[model samples]
Target: MSRSAPASQGSVVLQTLAAGKLGVWPLVFTVLAAAAPLTVVGSGATTGWAVTAVTGIPVAYIAVAIALGLFAVGFVAMARRISHAGAFYTYVTRGLGRPFGVATAFMAVLAYNAMQIGLVGGFGYITAGFLDGHGITVPWWLIAGAGVVLVAVFGVSRIDLNGKVLATLLIAETVVALVLAIAQVTHPAGGTLTYTTLQPAGLLGDEAGTALAIAITGFVGIEGTAVFAEETKDPSRTVARATFIALAMICGLYAFCTWAISVATGPDQVVARATAEGPELTFNLAAPYVGAFIVTIGRLLLITSLFAAMLSFHNTAARYFYSLGREGILARWLGTTAPKSKAPRGGSLTQTGLAVIAVGCYAWFGWDPLTQMFFWLTVLGGFGVLLLMALTSTAVVAYFARLRTGDASGVTSSILTGVLAAVALGWISVQTVFDFNRLLGLAPDDPVARILPALYLAAAVAGLLWAGYLAARRPHVYRVIGDGAAAAIAPLTAVPHPAVPR
Candidate 1:
């Protein structure tokens, strides 16, 4: 296979990333580190109050984590076969085709963008809210705008360095937060865990579905291992193990914490109480168990956690763009790597610029981050992920169908699992879009909610169009799309295209 035009001696950058910069443990820690605590204060928990709500906070955590693990059963297996920079897009592209692969890449880019942008919006809110309590109120966009700059700096830096910093921050924040949560639950000043909350009489009737929905939000970044495939030393073995480890850590931590908190609040009043208090219920409850100082630390950690998440996804989002561009789908610029650092400079810059632009627009319009930006972006982002998973699973089945006929290995089982995963994910995509009423206003004004998925569709269409154009003009790049060919899997380099074309 022809490499994307031959390498230029001076213009082309060489690979700086070794096969195994990150071991299994570090990789798992990096991905799950950002998502674990985010469940507590994200839009899901905040607005869950508006829905069915949960006061016995621990119960909510327990339920949400386990449900997310269900996705892992199929996701990890796919991870084993499709280890590349494009992650799901690569899997489907090889299993499916270049055109559909481009579509998946677009979906991933949008999904990751929605997630990162939400963090930016909400991080500002948390900071401003904390300040407001101190009798000082500033605008939310200003804080968000600042965060975009910080994220860009980190996003363009070395991935290993980012991993190290994340490990330190995550370890400190989760450990302290967990200690506080455990203490509060075990020896609550308020109440004790009992059958009331566990079997909460009307749980299934009312809060069951609602709790499950909110819980899914906590596991948002579990697929993050996909993003690190290029940086991973042994992607097949490392990523496979990392995915399960991430799953276990996230689920185990959240479930136990939730169960503990349920004990503290006493299950009977959990739903009503969590609902009344809104997003503040967990933090408020912690003040007594952990002390005011600990609560303050938690608030600061929340800000950092959000920033960490934003940074993490920003990197992942850039790779989606990078993969698409390398395949000649989007612009060719995103395909370029930076020399010396060997990062996806073009893609990272694009993501950062877009995010900054979004922050600017929200600021210009004087829009509220909590109400407009956070709510819409996060929910829609979730929808994009569902679509990507569904489509990628389909691609897996397509890729493996031929092999299954002659062989009796797990190939057949893999295809079957992919088929089921695709179906489930597709249903979720439809439900999420149709159920905008839960997040948006009760009436026609809810159009904004529907727009997120619409944006995803538009982006996917654009990507497909680009892929078609590439197919017409550059057949070589187009053919490499889903085949997992050697040329398409170029090493991360920083060199510019040679002025002399092949």
Candidate 2:
């Protein structure tokens, strides 16, 4: 499809997004909603405790938090200067170049799309299981189809409405988890809530890499804080503050809840029990300590957590489409915002349509949504995100190193943290690649595991080529690549118009 000409020639008036609507709390809840606290507490915690061994699981969460925190130092620094819905993609473009920026944008699209679609599988599987426990019979795909409808509706509505819905669900799930954790701590299974699990020796233990990787996945949506910068009030501070707040919340919650589980189960038995019971491990602890009713409530909340995650991710994916569309990088029609709600309705519809097709395919093939689709695809998404983080880290260094006399905060904020974060994230990205098979629950030499990295590589290469084509043919469109997209398109007059369309 051909892109619309830029705004210079008075082509289509570039549509501006809704603005000054989101605040710190709403942004925090929206980003955290994507993390899905219940899923992290119940499923993710159990997996880390069991698959990676219990001793280091809690410590792993903290380490991942630190790594991400370091990454955020530079991330927020860049956000203050460039206020765009394109978070990592924009950072990479501004720091690296148009080609790398475009490539990372495609990578972000792939990663977030995979993540959103993957969460749908988990929602369907978990919801189906939750209903089955209550003696209600429903197909997983049917439930998933219904979710697509709801998410699409929310995706197109006002952003605050989505925030309220997400906040309610996030609070419900957090309350349940915190209650269970508090009970377990107050009435320790072994007569003490020990700090033994938080020790560094535990992190250096066997299968530590696997534990770290899973913990990183739990923080999957952390980087998305900047994605809503365009819509947030005083985004310069709001986005940065929300990023740290979300990070602290995830780190503290995951560490405490996992430790509480360990203490409640008796650290000695935690790993074995978790390995055997999986998600039910959390419920088992809650059954005796928090009551069976709360256990059921927690289960129900888990369903909502997954649903909240789906909705959060649906909004994120829609905005990525919106960013791409407005920049004339993708189909121009996808850039349109609803006149009343100012929502990226076109992108929202496109994402919803993709979800439907994905759910349909999973059902047609009779694949296990939990294992094949959710677990596998989410890991793949995590891999892509890690790759982008590493690239963005490098971009942070490049962007700052070249700046001689901007806000000194940019240089001070980025230089040290930029270098440290680049090394740390780069290491994790490499580790993720080597351990990809383990992440996918496949044999080390599994063909699918080996092939998955190629998908990301191919997308990046294709994106680079496309950026080149834009430079050679669609120069005006390429000039704004990774530049302040929302700013460029926000003003009706400054909107760029190229004489030729690609």
Candidate 3:
């Protein structure tokens, strides 16, 4: 393992990320925080019921969790073999080709940026509403701008420090959610606990696709478990354990809480309650049993949950930019790390700039922050991640087939898992596309639905064109598209394992 060398005599020097700083628990905290369980249950689930009029959200969460778990089998297998900060990009490059890898990289940037920036809008709207209830007259954008600054600060700090913050916030929010769920379940409507919403059969309806799509959004950050591989103590096992742990937590918590909501309100009235109260439905349901103090705490924790999500996604997006820049696919300067913190400074700054611009534009246009900025962008981001997962699943099978090493039975099982995951994920991606309008609460005829999904295709095409340019003009850089730090020294084919400084 060697350090990254300068690409040219006078080119910007690439710095390595801080390695061996994060362990399994830290990585798990970061992944879970990015998912933002409380916020997902409060706003996302409630919105799903109200907008999509879907009553099977609980079962939908379980189905998605199973699909993602299958996806992780091959995903983790690949991670053990190829360790890189650019998780999806590296996997796609090694398994598919450099052109597709570059395309995946661009899509990751766009998707993660959307997820991070969208959280700002959510934080603003929720924070503003919370303050308004207290007779404060602060604007949502103003609060959002402050959130952007906070995330920027944290994004450029040490990765483990960010993990600590996320862990604390995640723990608090999980407690609030558990307490609420318990209150909801114990006080079931009509003194009867119905298992209707928990059954898989509930997921068969006209709005089923929309419901599943919404559920997928709740797990948007699950794949990010591998994004921190470069910074982990043991990339081989830490990544796998953290990934499954985060997924299981997200699945169980979401399913139980959603089922409790249905039980508390009775299956017949859950949708109507969500429609009327929106995100407040959960708190309102439990306020009678738990009292106003815990409810108030839950409300405050929702704001913190949104902030945690923003910070987590900001780090994920910044690292993607850093990996791209280090590989010479983007500007070399974007690969530099802060000397003291060893954080991706250039990439963090770039992400911050994008967030500022997005928030400023939305505020200037006077768009509805909750619907247009938060819901639409986050849903679009989730769709992009879904696309990446489908492609990466195929890439897993291809990569393993090309290698043809390792235990024969294990390899065959991995290949089988990849095939199944690819098919399931591909179908879900298509379903999400068709139900895009429903996800956004838009009409079937709305052009925005078509336009939003088209952005990924455009990004992929642009990436391909750029890769072609690099292939002709800068063959050296093109040969190392997903090689991480080793890209500066030699081609990926020549490097068995690229090493980062401890």
Give all TM-scores, in the order shown: 0.81, 0.87, 0.90
Q: How would you encode candidate 2's per-residue C-alpha lDDT over 22-64 as one tens digit per residue?
A: 7899889978988988898887677555544546677878998
Give each prediction's root-mean-square deviation over alpha carbons.
Answer: 7.1, 6.7, 6.1
Model 1 agreement with the true structure over 1-502: per-residue lDDT tens digits: 4454333333333233443378897888787755746444423454554443444333544544443344444455555555344477777666666667777777788888887887788878878887877899887777788888877877777454466777877777777668766775767535444534344433344334334444555667777776666677666678778887777776666656555545555555545655566446666766675778877777777777877777777887887777667666668898788776788888999998889888888888888676567655665566667677678677767766744665545676677677776665565555556555554434536666567558888978987897788679976666566433344543332231221011
> Clash pairs of candidate 2?
6-496, 6-497, 7-496, 7-497, 8-496, 8-497
What value does the lDDT take at residue 451 in candidate 3?
A: 93
lDDT of each: 0.64, 0.79, 0.85
What stretches of model 1 exceed 4 Å from their correct place?
Answer: 1-21, 36-44, 51-74, 82-85, 133-137, 159-161, 183-213, 229-236, 256-279, 405-408, 441-445, 482-485, 488-502
- Rank by lDDT (best first): 3, 2, 1
Model 3 Cα lDDT, one tens digit per residue, 162-219: 6667788788888899999999999999999998888888767666677778888899
Least well predicted 10-residue stretch by lDDT in candidate 1: 493-502
CA error at residue 476 for candidate 3, angstroms: 1.4
Which candidate leads in TM-score? 3
